[model samples]
Target: MKVLIAMDSFKGSLSSKQGSEAIAAGIKEVYPSADTKMLPLADGGEGTVEALVEATKGTLFTVPVIGPLQEKIEATYGVLGDHRTVVIEVAAACGLPLIREEQRNPLIATTFGVGELINDAIERGYRDFIIGLGGSATNDGGVGMLQALGFQFQDRHGKEIELGGQSLKDIRRIDAENVSPALSEAQFNVACDVTNPLYGETGAAYIFGPQKGATPEMVEELDQGLRNFARIASEDLGKDIQNPPGAGAAGGLGAAFIGFLQGELKSGIELILESVKMEEQIKGVDIVVTGEGKLDGQTSMGKTASGVAQLAKKMGVPAIALAGSITEEAADLNEIGITSYFSILTKPMTLNEAIDPDTARQNLQVTTAQLFRLIKAFKQ
Candidate 1:
């Protein structure tokens, strides 16, 4: 029998690759002669760079860049096995976790480090870019990034505006004359999952500002700043950036990519699956196994597991999910493509115990072995 094992990171426990390995071990215990292919998967979020790097046998590079609060930090990016495509997760530099809870002010956050990452990759001769837009701590309309890339946002007096979301309202001009010339030769595929517009009740500021430490008053202020930036971009750059489905993602960085970088926004799962050539790998596998740390209603909403299962279903293969925990809402996943699901826990345990790497690994292996044993018995 042939099996394909693909798993997302188990959060505090196992990484995608590690989870896949544990599943593979279990399957081997039950079907020693079984052929299994292990793959690492991730949605275009926090673990994106690591997952894609492992999946494609890519190399990782670390660089020092400015953080959300204008502090210096080290961030990592990846170059795929092809040596052409570079993957960057915005969270690496300006993510919420980079700052303390008390310091989570979206008003002063910046994505300057994201731009610096791109610039560094470009200098390294990479022209193909996959930018993962998730977990950002900024609401600066991406002006901070644009500034790092040599796009000038100037005040009425022709002086450059300061960085951060708070400075969006001071822009009187947009200039692209000094942008990195190599940027024109680059192609950007942005992984964006949300569809919030740039400004409004459901937009970037109003929707995500609070999570980034904005109070109600700050949300309104940030919203107006985004509106002003949008208007200025429209007038000076000839781009209507505020209305796109994902323009509000990562605090308006989506708009910046769309308007200035000529980026194509796509579903995060779709982008990652394509990058890893998932469909091609699933072709002749007898069964596909996939899962994440948790399976909930959101799992079916463009998550890694759902993406894998849907593809397997289309190809006439059964897809089973194994998760650390399963919620009642996850039952709906059956309607999508998950043929069956299992939780890897053997007995009740505290959250800390459940997340212990060795414990989780053992659970995954034992659970997988038992499931495959039943399958083998039925086949006989």
Candidate 2:
């Protein structure tokens, strides 16, 4: 039998490539002669850089850039095998992980480093860009990033506003003439998975601020700042950025790309799958396995596993999802082409213990071996 193993990262425990190898090992043990293909998958979030880079034989470049808190740090982005297309994830430079739990203040965090990464790429003459917006630690509506790219945000007195989410409220003038002219020569494909608008109840601040260390008062302030920025973007820049689907992604960084760079927002999974040419590889596969660290109802909403299952269904192949934990809500995935779901854990254990690389590999192998045996019995 030919089995295709496509799995997302198990997060802190295992990477997508590691998970696929474990799954493949299990199937191999059950059927020594079985043909297996391993494909690592990600939904254009944290692991997007590694996933696309390896899958496309792309080259990764590291550059020094400012972190979320204005600290200097080394960040990485990739040039796909096509050489013309560059893939970047905002998380590399300004993600939440860069800040400690106590230091997680959205009001002060900035996306300036993200802009530096883009500027570095532009300096190299790369025009086509795939920017993944996720795991942000800021609610600045991307003003800091704009500032880094030569756009100036000033107060009513024409003084340059300081960088940070809180600084958005002081913006009264936006000077884009000094902005990088290279931007006009560029095209950005923004990989986003959420659909929250720019402001209001379900907006960036209200929905994501708490986790970014915002208090109730800060959330209100941040929301107002986003609203103010949106109004200015529409009136001054001639671009309506408010309340657009996905405008709230990455703490309103999505709006910045759409409003300033004229970027096209797309589903994260679709972009990743296309970049890897998954459609061309799914041919002639008997069974396909795909998954992530966790499987829940959200998995059906354009996540890596669901995206793989959708493609497998089109090819008339069954797709199975394996995860560290499978929630009851994951049943929703059944209607979306995932044939079945399984948890790698076989016996009860603490979350930390279960996620260890060695333990995870053993559990996955055992589960896969048993599953294959069941399939053989059914066929016989």
Candidate 3:
């Protein structure tokens, strides 16, 4: 029998590669002769770089860049085996975790580091980019990123605007004269899962500003700033991306990518699947195993496990999910082609204890062995 393991990272427990290896070990215990292939997967978020690097045997690059609060920090991105394609997760530079709860002010958080990472990759001759948009700490409409690319935002007096989301309001002009010339030859594929617009009730500010440490009043101010940015960008850049779906993702970084970089936005999981050529990997596989930190209703909505399951169904292959925690709502996954789902744990345990890497690995092995044994009996 041939089995394909394509599991997402189990959060704090097992990485996608480790999860796949554990399942492979279990399968080997039951069928020593079975052919097992492991393909780690991510939905273009936290584990995207690692997954793509592993899947394509790619190289990882780390560079020093400005953090969300202007602190110097090292950020990492990946270059795939093709060498021309690069994968970047925005959070590596300006994620929420970089700041403390007291320092979680979206008003001044910047995506400058994200732009620095991109610029560094560009300098290395990488023109194709797969940028993940998630876990951002800013709502500056991507102005900080544009700045790093040489797009200057000037005030009414022609003075350059300051960095951060709040600076979007002072923009009187966007001068692209110094923008990186290499951008003209680049292609960007942005992975964004949300559909919020640039500014309004369901827009970046009202929906996400609070989470980035904005109060009710700050949310209002941020929303106004985003609106101003959209207006100026439409007038100066000749593009109106304010109401486009996914424009508000990652604190309006999505809008920045679309409006300024002319990037193509796609569902995170879909982008990941395409980038890694997942369909081609699963061909002739008897079973596909995929999972994540949790199996919930949201998993059906373009999460990694569901994305893999859907593809497996199209190829007439059975797919099963193994998660760190399984929720009642995950039953919705059945309609989306997951044959069934299982939690790795055999007995009840606290969340912290259950998430221990070694414990999770052992649980995964035991559960996978049980699954294989059941399949063997069913074949009889």
- lDDT for 168 in candidate 3 is 84
What lDDT score goes with residue 177 in model 3?
100
Give per-model TM-scores: 0.97, 0.95, 0.98
State the local distance difference test value for candidate 3: 0.91
Please state the error at residue 282 of candidate 2 in Å.
0.3
Model 3, total clashes:
1
Clashes of each: 0, 0, 1
lDDT by residue (tens digit), candidate 3, 175-234: 899987898788999999899999999999999998899999889889999988888888
Q: Give me the runs in candidate 1 sitting further than 4 Å from their true place.
A: none
Model 2 residue 321 CA deviation in Å:
1.4
Residue 1 shift from truth in candidate 1, angstroms: 2.5
Model 2 regions lying over 4 Å from their true place: 376-380
Error of 2 at 73 (Å): 0.9
User: Could you give candidate 1's per-residue lDDT for residues 63-155 as a string of tens digits?
Assistant: 999999999999999999889999999999899889999989988999999999999999999999999999999999899999999999999
For model 3 the TM-score comes to 0.98
lDDT of 2: 0.90
lDDT against the true structure, per candidate, is: 0.94, 0.90, 0.91
Please give the lDDT score at residue 237 for candidate 3.
82
Reference-based lDDT, residue 10, model 3: 88
